[model samples]
Target: MIREGVMNQAQKLLAGLKIPALQAPMFLISGPEMVINACKSGIVGSFPTPNARTPEILDQWMAEITEQLSSAQNPAPWAVNLIVHPSYPRLEADLQVILKYKPPIVITALGSPKNVVEAIHSYGGVVLADVVNTTYAKKAASAGVDGLVLISAGAGGHTGYLSPFVFVNEVRQWWDGAIVLGGGISTGKNVFAARAMGADAAYLGTRFIPTKEALCVDEYKQMIVEASSDDIVTSDAITGVKANWLRQSLLNAGLDPDNMTAKGKIDFASNGADNKRWKDIWAAGQGVSASESVSDVSSIVNLLAREYVSAASELTQTLKPGNRE
Candidate 1:
């Protein structure tokens, strides 16, 4: 996604961030506390609009996020994700809430963001579209979004198939605005690597799922802490969309990971049955192995900041003219 003025808007948005990253929005998992904490911790915090249960709740959540962030010292900006797909019954209603809150950033998923681009831009909001392939990326760029969140291979729920390296390189050829790469990004070194790969930021979701502010139960977080890359299974059987899930979670939900088949459909309705399925069969990315334990958002961010600095320093020394082989 790209636009003339949007490039400036993206710069302003990124300028306030302590790190070049976003706490990728998660359905039913991310909420106000998570968003607030993530922002306060010097990174963009976000959650899907549907997580609020209704448009009114969405309004409340936005208000809460804005109100809390208002007084924080040097807090990073916050974002809200919207399901712009025509089939989503709440698109119009959610847009209304979004317009009122005017979050610094708005992320669109599951459809073209063209419809809401003008509205969001009218309020000086940056619109970033979630795309998994080059086709979607081109379409979103044409639609004039401020940026594109590339959901590459190894992402958790509603995953992408392309490797981050290939996806970022392909998109960078034509779109140089802002590319936030999501998938298998859990550590600070990964964040630095995203920049090295020509991405503006790293989109992290699974790494934060076990954080204290996440809405999931303790058991889900525990499972993430215990799992590894080998324990991740990709299948559309659960949500009718290709997604990564914890192998043990699938078995716990009585579905064999190896033979998993589409059983549920995509539905963003707050009370949709799909919610139950997601709640029961937890989703996580291959990066689960990096999570050592459940921790606070601030602590995790601090750790990432430390690791990012360390990685940058190491790379700098390695690239020195004298050190190079």
Candidate 2:
């Protein structure tokens, strides 16, 4: 009965996204402006709760996004990303902020979200657990999470090793619940492809990094424009987890891109490595290849919508009138 309840709640929350897409909450990239504008464009917008410098700022960001959405003629719900890991000393504190605001959706990553699922559900909020493989997917589903975010290989941050084609099908084999796929999903074609592959929605990040609403520096945006799939390097040196980052950022920090090592386990409470961290050296997905320059959130979403319609129309023509794939 609890699973059934969560399943309905997950679908209800996601249904608010008119375009069937949700922006991925990237570290140091997602912020209030980004989330607000994206929601205004009829898609789910989101930011990690930890992105705020302090608890006060986190509260302010949540309030601003909520107020703006409430006043809009037609707006989609927003989401918050919570690091459920213990090393994050602010996890409990951030959860309190979420409880106060009760954002429509909460996405948990990096640790067990069992307790978080219960707390969020108590307030009628939806919880989506982030997983890289079937092992984590089964565990999260058993914990009563409303949905699962399949972070396959080519994803920007702390990526999974399996391909999306393999991982999505494998997860669907066992769970019939809501599943959103994330990896190198950048284009409108990719968004349509995700739905065709049995995903409820596409989780996108790298493509949004170059938007004006993002909080990153100018150079970071340019680097993303200059990057391609080959320029990305997966290494655990920065965050103590194997994440995809720009190869040039590592070279800029004076580290041998091929031979890098971490001196200690990562502390989620603080910025990654003391000397070189995400602030300087950045992380992005293989999807950067599709990104060319910076633009506003509205324009970007408009472009994706046009592309999605065109691609869907093209795909529709391939099948016979009365036949299904």
- Highest-TM-score candidate: 1
Clashing pairs in 2: none
Candidate 1 C-alpha lDDT tens digits along 61-175: 9988889999988889899999887668889999999999899899999989999999999999999999999999999989989889999999989999999999999998888
> Candidate 2 — which residues are off by over 4 angstroms?
1-7, 261-264, 272-276, 322-325
Across 48-128, the per-residue lDDT of candidate 2 in tens digits comes to: 887897889999999999899999978888899998988888888899999999998999999878989888998989898
The 10-residue segment of model 2 with minimum total lDDT is: 1-10
Q: Against the true structure, candidate 1 has what lDDT?
A: 0.90
Candidate-wise lDDT, in order = 0.90, 0.86
**Candidate 1 clash pair list:** 237-261, 237-262
- For model 1, the stretches where C-alpha displacement exceeds 4 angstroms are 1-7, 322-325
What TM-score would every model get versus the actual structure? 0.95, 0.94
